[model samples]
Target: MFTLKIITANGNEVIHAAQDPIFHQASNTITFQGYDNLSNSVTLGEGLTSAGGDVAYLMGASGATLATWRYRQPVQCGSSLQPMDC
Candidate 1:
């Protein structure tokens, strides 16, 4: 199963949203599709830095294009979002 959570706040008020816990097994590395989108991307990394902020480490495989990650500045998780690039 896969679970994802997103929390948001307006002013001092806050709200919580989470998905069911989804599980996966990765012996060496893990790969999945549709993660380029925001909603499905929640299950990709260990933690969220800030919206769009990411740090990816790819192992040696074959093609250079096969081992790449997309990392922006602001990452989104819970209610806190920050600009990791700045």
Candidate 2:
């Protein structure tokens, strides 16, 4: 099962659009980090903004942290997905 969860810093949750291709990629990459980020920033920029101060992660079925989800990148692309609109 692919799991991507985003919980806000204020104790709220950010629900992902499951069918969104952006999320599909985020949920798939297990070794994502740094410049190789599995970014959700594009989604966040579009309208997925409840995740601003989020505690987000991509998890494996065994409950390990595969990757951490990033919410936004002001003037750049945070991942291999769509580039952030500048």
Model 2, CA-based lDDT:
0.45
Against the hidden reference, what TM-scores do the models get? 0.18, 0.41
Candidate 1 — worst ten consecutive residues by lDDT sum? 7-16
RMSD of each: 15.0, 10.2
Residue-wise lDDT of candidate 1 within 1-86, one digit each (tens)? Answer: 12122221111221112222222222112233333332332323333433432233333223122233333335554565643332
Model 2, 1-86: lDDT tens per residue? 43556665566675442222233233222232223334334232223445454455666667777767554444535655442463
Off by over 4 Å in 1: 1-42, 45-52, 61-66, 71-86
Worst 10 residues of 2 by lDDT: 27-36
TM-score of 2: 0.41
All candidates' lDDT scores? 0.29, 0.45
